[model samples]
Target: MPTITEAYVDSLAPNAGAIKNGRDLIKKNSFPVLNESPDATLLFGECNGSGKEPYRCSVDFVNEASPVFRCSCPSRQFPCKHALGLLYARAMGSPFTPAEVPQDIADKRDKAEKREEKKKDAAESEGNAPAAKRKVNKSALVKKFASQLEGLRLLEKLVLQLVQSGLGSVDKKTVQMIEEQAKQLGNHFIPGVQAKLRAFVHTMQTEGDREAIYSQAMEQLLLMHSLVKKGVSYLEKRMENPELPMETGTSLEEQLGHAWQLAELREYGRAQSGAELLQLSFLSYADAARGEYVDAGWWVDLSDGTVRSTRHLRPFRAARALKEEDTVRAVVRTEELFVYPGEVNARVRWETATQREAGEADYSKVKAAAAASYADVVKQVKNIIKNPLADKTPVMLVAFRSIDKTADGLCLRDAQGKLLPVTDLKTNGSATSALIALLDEKDLRDQAALVMFSHRLDDNRLSVQLMSIVTDSRFIRLLY
Candidate 1:
């Protein structure tokens, strides 16, 4: 059995809010009773919640791979804060008094085992029945493609008009017209493009430095143009085939506003087996135009050097039902990890995951995976973002001999003394780089850092954002 780690407990949380609430309990010392079974497979705690009576929470890990979370709380959230707090406390090396397994939990486990046995027998009785195949709606795809093409033409025309007329000529009426055209994209089932258009409109709407706004507007137009050009060809080809295989290298469907299913990804040979992932950083933001709150976490594949992301989209309309994602500090081991189509840091999802503590070997692997040279990684990143449709911001781990603040910016020196400038607050619209100043001298030397390559169109410079700094002794994350 593996030891529970901080990352594993974070993974069990429904959302960031739950993790915060759970952490608050530990900080306040609200749990008076923290006990574990003799073998430590079962953990029980009493956490004070809103109600006067404390909530009794039990996490039964009789099955190490898939533990059962049971809590006496009114929250619709599974494995509510109380249960998560208990797991967090355990991971933090909290001392739990040895105790016998509760008889009720033991009985429940017995019933569960019997149910599982029945399920296994029933499944075996089926005797190699083939799985059902889902039908494809070709007509729907065709109509969508046609409508999207029309929408693209309209979008291009709008941009051309705006550009030709110049920003100075744009008035309220013009903005209204642009808004109407952008809204039509929703009808074409390309809400992703629609969101980009809305962002462009927002840039125009905001009262800011005129020159800056113009530059931003141009950048938005360029980004959208990239999508439209490639998207046109992609949709046309898909329309002709109606069953074209999904692209694994680029996010064509995302731009076309298609939500991919796990089955589709697996069928397209995009699923990786026996994957081990560890989170490097987490991010959360509100998508105003889409009325959705998006939370994304970046995780490095311990098996390989590739970094993947897990995104949770909670729409305002479904906020109550959907949970917002948070940080996971544990190593995620899964049988099948579905990879979504995109550029660097492709979105990933898994139906089930088992997490355990990362050992020294694991940490060493991460350090070993870091690119020893800065120039090589930057060259690769530049090549990827050359295309307008390419994902500009991609996380890369780079080994640094030392970090020094120079006249330019926070620069990381390689063995060759080749410096890569980073730690720009405006690089990725984040102030996380400021955290580096708080670090002592020892932590800044002979380590590697995870950086996101961000292209600042305003400066016409490709900036690097330091997401976290990892050393043999510590992994300090600067991003949330």
Candidate 2:
């Protein structure tokens, strides 16, 4: 590592905040400069953070690696402070190399200029040198296409059957049928076709005239059928000869899936557990008409994808809760992993668990399981609430006031404070054993703090809440 002098650090004054943040991170944890490119003047760094995934930040060194981009934290300011600090660190004498600017960034800048030039050359035409491109096996694709077509045809038949049964409209049952059919098709191969169909259905709901909507769907289906028929023969012949254009759908899935999967792969469930999530909360102070941004959540890095773990915070220090939104952006390694399921109308369940080790093992007697330590339980609980595994399964009772009144059922409350009575937090059919186990864990016996639970009942409905964990303490243990 080269020694970065105080003089070189002065050059990053424009990005002082970033420099400070990055340096602070280094003081507590090591974030080596990961990569740098001389031509693009870009530098990248990977940070050490608590989560299932690591954090990465990049600075445009040519632009003075002044903390232009950060992927872990929630703040949106460009050149995040972390990036700045890293560049400053590197400038001082880090052993980093400059490489060719990555194509994506370069292409991005190139397209911007190209669009501008189009105004001067309206008739402009250009082509790169022709190269032999790998051909897709049309036969295999046709077979896959035929299978999906059959599934859709079955779905269409099912829809017709519903109509025959005097179904006036596409109701809940019809949608379920459609979803099931879509899921089956999705399992067959094409990944995003189901989502596309769902989107079409949503669009149909917006426009009046159910018949017209059905007609439109029929047309789209026909077009799909026709496209398949036209390409099948050529695809089959090409497959035998091994020469054809690459299939479009596969790339689309790869591009979209890669981003989503990459984010999923990096998520570390244990990081959000314990006191951190319980105590973690945020506030937004905004001066409208100026620029306004709030700290949403943390970011976690998994093996393949990057996830931005965020929480919607009620105005804690501010006058009121400001505007909040969630977005997934693979363009700059930022993502919002859906922790709790049933987010739109239903409650989602998110939980993290950390196991505690029992100190001594009993050799003579059948070895008794060691009780989990309170600290370990608390940690696990935090992560669970922070980044839950599924957004579909709702847990029972998010928070409970006291364990004494077991009959005093926990009520689900909306943001408007409407009380939604629930039969059980764990729901019917499925035993509430898991919920009870988490609640009865001896680790929580000592602290009378707010307890958060994912209340589930028989149906798909779920309720979440933050209850008073302690009768004495002033603090509200955020149940995430």
| Model 1, span 1-480: residue lDDT tens | 357676667767877688888888899998999999989789997888777899889998777777898988887898788898998898888889989988888899999999999999988876477755667799987997899888887788877887789888989999898889887777877888898899888889989689978877887889888778888888789889987776666787887677898878877789988899988888888777678888888888998878888898999899877766777777789978999998778889987677766666777888899999777987998898887777767788889999888998788899889887784544235677678889989889998888887777656766688898888866888997
lDDT of 2 at 432: 29
Q: Return the TM-score for each candidate structure.
A: 0.87, 0.26
Which parts of model 2 are misplaced by more than 4 Å? 1-80, 84-169, 204-243, 247-480
The lDDT for every candidate, in the order shown, is 0.82, 0.39
* Residues 1-480 of candidate 2: C-alpha lDDT, one tens digit per residue: 212344334333333354467567656645644577765456666666666565666654333212235456565654455665566556555566565666665675577568758955653442343533445666776676565455545545654554466434667767676667756756545343444445444534555666656655654344334333434443345445554433332223221122223223223221222221111112233322122343343222222212223444333354233433322111111122233222211211133211111111211011111112333433443444443212222222122222332354644332333333323222112222224335443423333322223423225333333322222222222322
lDDT of 2 at 444: 33
The TM-score, computed over Cα atoms with residue i paired to residue i, of candidate 2 is 0.26
Worst 10 residues of 1 by lDDT: 423-432
